[model samples]
Target chain A: MSGAHLLVRVGETTAALPAAAVRRVVRSLRLHPLPGAGEGLLGLAEFAGEPLAVLDLARLMGAAGVAGASPAVTVVTWIGPAGDRELVGLAVDEALEVAELDLGAAAAGAGEVLVAERPVRLVDLERLGEEA
Target chain B: MSPELVVVRRAGALWGVPAAAVAAIERGPEGVTVRLAGGRELGAEAVVGLSGEVSVRGLAPPVRRRLPPAVAGLALWNSEPVAVLGVAAAPAGGRR
Candidate 1:
């Protein structure tokens, strides 16, 4: 089956998330740190007047932490099955364009697609939500 | 005594796989190939022959404790830490 994927740069690597899962991509916003927030969570940001947890996709993928400064954009995404959706913001260094991915039926696990000749890690939002 | 380990580099990180678990090591045009016992082949930047036991002590926790499901854990190599990715975990695009 074919599906749209939003390509974004997390640190030096490129990653893709299902376009249907992404609500919107927004420029950097003021963040409010949540003390004692567990791993992968950078902080909190307000999206559409609701508090959204910001996740560090780079860190989540086992990449080194982003140095120098925070990401410039956040891709808001919906996780979990319909009727139980949760909103989350993914911090990305750059918001790349969307691409129509073949998403073959065999697609499963983490590393499953190559976009623009670079291996793109497929973010499993449902699994991530369960972890969170 | 420490266990023997096979060291390989991937995605700029050093990984240590138990030597017993490695089925074969081959060189390819793109990079070295590590064949695990389970029949999975992984591209490696460099594969160092079996080495002595590695001390797990004093290794810091991964920056993100809950790594992507594919990663097994992080371990130190030559005084630096690298992620030890799960061999059974298929690469992006399912081994394409």
Candidate 2:
């Protein structure tokens, strides 16, 4: 990655969502649970007096024990393709840091970015809306 | 134009039934009776009457496929989400 990425902790793993798409990393949101909502959706929350959909990032990554985890931050981001972007919130365990990393030797679709000798998955935000 | 909705607590979450789809709503000791225009009456709780201009956010396809058939979309009441109910979508009874 030649650009800045927002690194965060989702469950026990480190992941990155491009900084350009990240609008804010706020304190844990007071999310209103949606009854009968699927596991993917955390629930709706208020941001600037608007209802925002908050998704469980750890659950999307197939991480375990997300229900028991106390999410510390809500990463507000706009995902989806250009001109058709949708703003959504990601409930993550912690907000690490914004890092500038170089992935010159890795191939496209390799999925992992080397951060401090650890492999951090480059989160495919588009899938957040599409995934089951 | 968004129709006025009868926001009620049902099954589990807060649900909104279009006022146009409701024939009458009467509160008693049991709870609120959301009588539909089609002559079917369903029991609901915490009936918040005559909500106007409830802008709904259509559920994504993945979420839609998983939701109950009665759910139309999601909207807000005092900044909290209320599942907007389509016609004939109100819960029959019971808190699920």
Candidate 3:
């Protein structure tokens, strides 16, 4: 299926999220760590009067563990079906742009694609949120 | 004859995998996961690129002794030695 996708950089790789699942993109926001939050969960941030759970995409993807810096932006996303969705904020290095993606033609696992000759991984947001 | 290889950068070392054994290299939710010819998927930090052609030359055969459990053997590429990773030994979520 053809739909819009939000492209964001996580560490050295670029990843895409379904535009429909994304609420908005924001600059680095203060995150309050949640006690006992499991791995990959960065913390929580306030958005639309609600506490949005933030996740480190880099950590979730198990990329090279680089600890010196924090993500410079966040992509707020919602998971699950309508009316029962949960808000999540994904921390990323940069928010690139929205682009048209053919989900069918993308790679089977993680929906890989090439943009400007560089490979961009299209994340399965639903699966990612569920696993996290 | 030389073996065709795909060079990968994991942790801080370079590794080689026979190119024919790789089914697909895609971005995974947890990082770069390579689909092996056997259909198993494992995560990777970065895929350096294929080495094209590599000659074993004077290098000794991959020895069972003096090597880590995960490494299958040793080979020379660009005049340096690289570990031949046993992809099956890769962790569930890829190399940490």
Which has the greatest TM-score? 2
Ranking of candidates on TM-score, top first: 2, 1, 3
Selected candidate, larger TM-score, 2 vs 3: 2
Ranking by lDDT: 2, 3, 1
Better of 2 and 3 by lDDT: 2
Cα lDDT for residue A60, model 3? 66
Q: Candidate 1, residues B6-80: lDDT per residue as tens digits? A: 877665445566676678888877678778787876677778545676542211122233344444543445544
Interface RMSD per candidate (angstroms): 15.2, 2.8, 23.6
DockQ of each: 0.02, 0.44, 0.01
Give the winner by DockQ.
2
Report lDDT (Cα) of residue B55, candidate 2.
80
Clashes of each: 7, 1, 1
Residue A93: error of model 3 in Å? Answer: 0.7
* Total backbone collisions, model 3: 1
Off by over 4 Å in 2: A67-70, A81-84, A101-109, B39-42, B61-66, B88-94
Q: Per-residue lDDT tens digits of candidate 3, residues A1-132?
A: 778999988878888899988988998676655333356666545565544556777776666432433458989887544444556677888889999987776855357877777787878765564443
- Candidate 2 residue-wise lDDT, B1-96, digit = tens: 376888887655677888888888888786778889877666776686568887876655445654677777777787667778787666565545
Candidate 3 chain B minimal-lDDT segment of 10 residues: B57-66
